[model samples]
Target: MKTRTWAPYALIAPTLVLMAVFLVYPIASVGWFSLRHHTVTQPWKNGFIGFENFRRMLFEDQLFWQSLVFSAKWVVVEVGLQLVLGLVLALIVNETFVGRGLARSLVFSPWAVSGVLTTGIWILLYNPSTGIFQQLAQWGIGDAGTSVLGNPETVFPATVVTELWRGVPFFAILLLADLQSIPKDLYEAASVDGAGRWRTFVSITLPHLRDAIVLSTLLRAVWEFNNVDLIYTLTGGGPANQTTTLPLYVARKAVDSHDFGYGSALTMAGFVILLFFSILYLRLSKFGSRA
Candidate 1:
């Protein structure tokens, strides 16, 4: 009885310690740093300054607001498009057909690729002088020497397309897994009761996928909001910072400027905004209530 009581705690102790060391400690440190003057380059000015960083970030920083707006736009467009395309892709692969295994593998291969590699491949493809566009131009399809990344007018869409290549696979794989778990009996019953494809999908499939869609979208939104690797390497938040998200801005502040205090404040702001939205979304969507 005594061992049983302590066994659970003992089993979880290592995980609890790891979480404290990695997650809790870092979050606490960031919170503490957010309220201080902790710039690495200016050690002479290092001291506690309550809410000064937040004050400057919330009211005085134009880049912060700009990055926040871009982050919102980026998340909305990326997640919305990925969800739709992923659902379609998942549905296609879920159906019984010749080469289904090969098709599913090919569809999911992009998600297996690392962000750095994906960015590298896209960069090579986007090269103005020696890329797909140049090839098309040589074939008399479009103009030559088209710099998609360099052009402010096209950079946003280019980045979106590039990210969609990698992101859509994630949603597809996740949704596909959930889709397979759906009982076949429901579909058979719906079909026998005179339900057509679209009607059956609307009545049975969508509802069954509700929790997965909500959870996946929320997780992907949080991830995309924090995503800096691909965007950093691909665009470096360039074309006049048009592609810069909030996380990218924070990276610039903390890394480029060594303004740890300000960066911490920005991180805190992101955390609050993300938490609020996540809660609101789960509540509004009534997540997990269906299944």
Candidate 2:
């Protein structure tokens, strides 16, 4: 019995060691850095400073609050839309139809694309002079130079749509996997009971998908909140910092300003916010609870 227990731990020892070295160590380093006055630009000022970074972030930085608010909005909007759209796509693809295999492959292709590539693709598509909009304008649809990314009014929506294009595929793939695992017997039973499609879906399909939906949404929310690549590459949080997220702000702090300590503080703040939101969301949704 002891050998059996020890064997499992021995097998997993390398994995645990790697996690401690890579994940735990980085997180601990960031936490420690957050308490210090460390900036690459000003090496002389690099020293221990307790809670000073947090105080400045909380009380002095308006951009921090702005980025936090945008991060919240970005997560909520992106995750919600991705969930709804992905569920719809999954349901559609789950149904028997011609070219279903091809359709699934095509739809899921976007998820395989890297964030930087997606950003690049969308940048070309959104370019005012040579993009789809310009082509449409040539067809006498609208103005010839409608700068979506440049305009503050349209930038947010445009960015959201661009992200949705790439993000929806991920949710669809996950939800579709879960959908496939659902037994057909439930549907047949519901059909025999004269349950309409809507009723059957409500009573059977949704209940079965509850855990998957909750978990997927939670993960997607966290990803969207921390998502910097697409937004950074596409918008660079430009047009007056309208699309700046917390992660993007941290990136700027670290890269642009060389404020590693303050960046670490921001990173810690993000961790806390995500942790709180995840706990609250899971609790409220009663995730993993029996129906």
Candidate 3:
């Protein structure tokens, strides 16, 4: 009995050790640093003041709240769009048709694209002079203004669209899996009762997909909240603070300003907010133990 229990631990020991070194240790260090004030002006000489960094960030920094709000809105739109578009694609792919396998591969091909590549491609498309949109703008149909990502009016929504291009593919694939997992017999039974496609989807398909949908939504929300790469590469959160989300703000504080402690405090705050969103998703999902 002891050997059996120990065997499982032995197999996962490396993974646990890696998590401790890479994940847990860094998180704990960030917590420790966030409580102190470390500035480049003082360099090595530093003094600790508990909660001061957090207090300053929470109350005094207006950008913090703005970033939080912008990021919240971004997630709301991104997750919603992902769900709608992904579900549509999954439903289409689930149909019994020839060449569906190839069709699915084509649809999900974008998921293999790197985040950096996606941002870069979108930036090119947003370029004023030679971009696809710019050409369309000349014809009076598309946005012909300055850099789409650089426009205060357009930046947030524009970036969200770019993000969607990458995100929807993954969402579609996951939803497709969930859609395939649903048994065909359920639909047959529903049809026998004179139920239509919409009724069967509502009664049978959606119930089976609830768990996958919850998992995908929560994962996407968390990752999107932490997304610095896409925003940083796309517009650098300009033409003003319009596109600046929490991650970008934290990056500016840490890397650009070289205020480690303040940035760490910002990171802590972000972690707390994301954690709350996660807990709320869990509560809403009715996720019980996998019995």
Candidate 4:
């Protein structure tokens, strides 16, 4: 009888155990390390420094604050563009069109490619002498495409371009699913009632897609916040820290500088920011409904 009563808990025991072993332990260790000093000079010995790391991150270190701001900007621009462009592309492919399959396949293929590869491709494309973008700029679209990565001003935006390349496909596939699920009858009824295309889209399509829109925004925001590989490969937070984001900052501090305590604190800070915003978004969207 006791065994039967605990059966569900027993089934979940492995998951709990794994969490403790992997997630919980590492996080706790990291938190502990963050409150102390660790470096290659004194690898084993750690001196507890209280909240000094956080203090430095908040006040003294301009780099930390700058990286945080840069990350926020990246999130705003990249995710905003992805949401708009992805939805537009999804809408385009949702209609009856020639070569729909080919269009979707091409649009979504970028997502299948890894972020590192995408970054590498963009790096090549941004090469001053041999880049296609540079070559095309001479033809028409202004000199805006000239070795974008090499330019300090364009480095951040240029890095964001790579992220968009790898991420747009995800949004397209998700939004396409939402679009397909909208009943054909709704469109037909709207047509019968003389509702114009734009009106029908505003009234029926957008309303029905609220959940998907919210979900996509939330997912993309989190992914952008936690991103490392995209920026790491594309710019190395480079062209004089123009492309530095929080994740890259954490990697540089911990891995490169071996300032484990500061780095761990930074990582924890990023994680908390990511987690808090995600929770806040879910709560607001879930309960603060339009209805």
Candidate 5:
């Protein structure tokens, strides 16, 4: 027993050490920095200023609140659409058909692409002069010089669609894997009972997929909350900060304003919000209850 216990620890020692160095240490450092008045531009003012950064963020920053609201909206809209579309895609691809292998690969290909590349592709598509809109205009479908990204009225929806193109595939792939793991016997039994497709799905398929759907939604929510690359590259929170998210706000704080202390405080606030939401979501959803 002693040897076994020691061997397990020895095997895991490197992983634990790496986690400490990479994850725990950075988190601890950020916490420490949050209580200070550190700024790259104003080095002379760098020092401890307990709770001041938090105070400013809470009471004085309008942009912080705006970004927080936008972040909530962004996560909700993006995750909801992605979940619906992805579930449909997963179900369709799960069905046995000719060319299914190639279809699955093609449908899932977007999830493998990097966010930067996705943003670049979207930028080209959304461009005013030579984009899809222009091509369509040549065929007399719509007006040319339609700037979707530049117009505030269309920017939010445009950004959501761009993200959905990549985000849906992630959900589809994950849910599809879980869908495949479901025992074929259950469906056979349902069919024998003369259960309709909708009834079988509601009774068997949904219950089986409950845990996966809950977990994936949570993870995708967090990811969308933190996602800055596509938005930054595509919109840069343009058209009067309509697309600005909390993470993008933090990036601007740290990068543009050189306010490390304020940025750290914002980061901590985001972490707390995410933790509270995750816990609340799991509790309300009754996750793992079926298992």
Candidate 6:
């Protein structure tokens, strides 16, 4: 009887220990550090400075506000566009037709690429000297040697396009899985009722995808908000920090400037914002309440 009682705890002990060592410890450390002056470059100044980092971040940091705004914009644009495009792609691929398998593979291939690798591939395409724009210009298009990444006017759209190329595939895959789980009878029933394609889709497909759409949008929003690798490699938050997100700013402070204390503070702020928004989004979307 004691063995049975203790066996479950023993089986799960390793996982609990691993979480404690990794997740819990790191989070606790970040909270602790956020109240200090722990700069690697200025060891002599290392000491407890409770809320000073937060004070400066809140009252004095313009870049902090800018990064937050940009992060919000990036998440909204990316999630919205990815959801729409992904849904369209998912619907298209869900249909039975010749070469369907290959087409689906080709469409979803971008999601398999690493962020850095995606950035590298896009860099080649965005290169002013020998990129697609230059080739188009040679064929009497817009202009020769267009600096898509370098120009501030065009950088945001260019970055958005690059991210969309990778992000949309993720949405497509998730929505497609949910799409497949939907009952054929529901769609057929609508069809038998003399419903048009658009009516059937609206009445059947969208209703069934509501929960999945909500969950996916929330997940994608969080992921995009925290995304750093592709933006870090592709834009480096460049063109006067125009593309910088909150995570990118934190990376700059921690990794580039060796300001762990300030970075921890920024990280804490990000955590709060993400948690708040995630809760609000789930609440507003009525996630998990659908029958």
| List of clashing residue pairs for candidate 5 | none
Give the whole-model CA lDDT for all candidates, comma-separated.
0.92, 0.91, 0.85, 0.85, 0.93, 0.93
lDDT by residue (tens digit), candidate 2, 1-291: 446467898889999999999999999999999999999989998999999999999999999999988988999999999999999999999999999999999998999887899999998998877999899888999876668998889999999999999999989999999999989999999999999999999999999999889888888888898898899899999889889999999998888999999999999999898888789777857766955
Q: What is the lDDT of residue 255 in candidate 5?
A: 80
- Candidate 4 Cα RMSD (Å): 3.3
| Model 6 residue 25 CA deviation in Å | 1.2
- Cα lDDT of model 3 by residue, 1-291, tens digit: 446467898899999999999999999999999988887867875669899988998789998999989899988999999888998888899898999999988988878887789888877887878998878877899567677666677777788788888889878889888888888888888999999888888999889988888888988888888888888778777777777899999898877888889999999988888889888877776666544
Could you list the CA RMSD of all candidates, in the order they appear?
Answer: 2.5, 2.6, 2.4, 3.3, 2.5, 2.6
Scored against the true structure, residue 30 in model 1 reaches a CA lDDT of 96
* Model 2: lowest-lDDT 10 consecutive positions: 1-10
lDDT of 6 by residue, 5-55 (tens): 778999999999999999999999999999999999999999999899999
Query: How many clashing pairs in candidate 1?
Result: 0
> Which stretches of model 5 miss by more than 4 angstroms?
1-5, 278-291
Model 2 RMSD, rounded to 1 decimal: 2.6
Q: What is the lDDT of residue 121 in candidate 1?
A: 97
Backbone clashes in each candidate structure, one number apiece? 0, 0, 0, 0, 0, 0
**lDDT per residue (tens digit) for residues 53-171 in model 5:** 99999999998999999999999999999999999999999999999999999999999888799999998988988899899988999787669998889999999999999999999
TM-score of 1: 0.93
List where candidate 2 sits over 4 angstroms from the true fold: 1-6, 277-291
Per-model TM-score versus the true fold: 0.93, 0.92, 0.90, 0.89, 0.93, 0.94
Query: 165, model 3: CA deviation in Å?
Result: 0.5
Q: Sort by lDDT, best first: what order?
A: 6, 5, 1, 2, 3, 4
TM-score of candidate 4 against the unseen true structure: 0.89
Instruction: Give the poorly placed runs of model 3, Cα more than 4 Å off.
Output: 1-5, 40-45, 137-143, 280-288
Query: Candidate 1 at residue 223, lDDT?
Result: 90
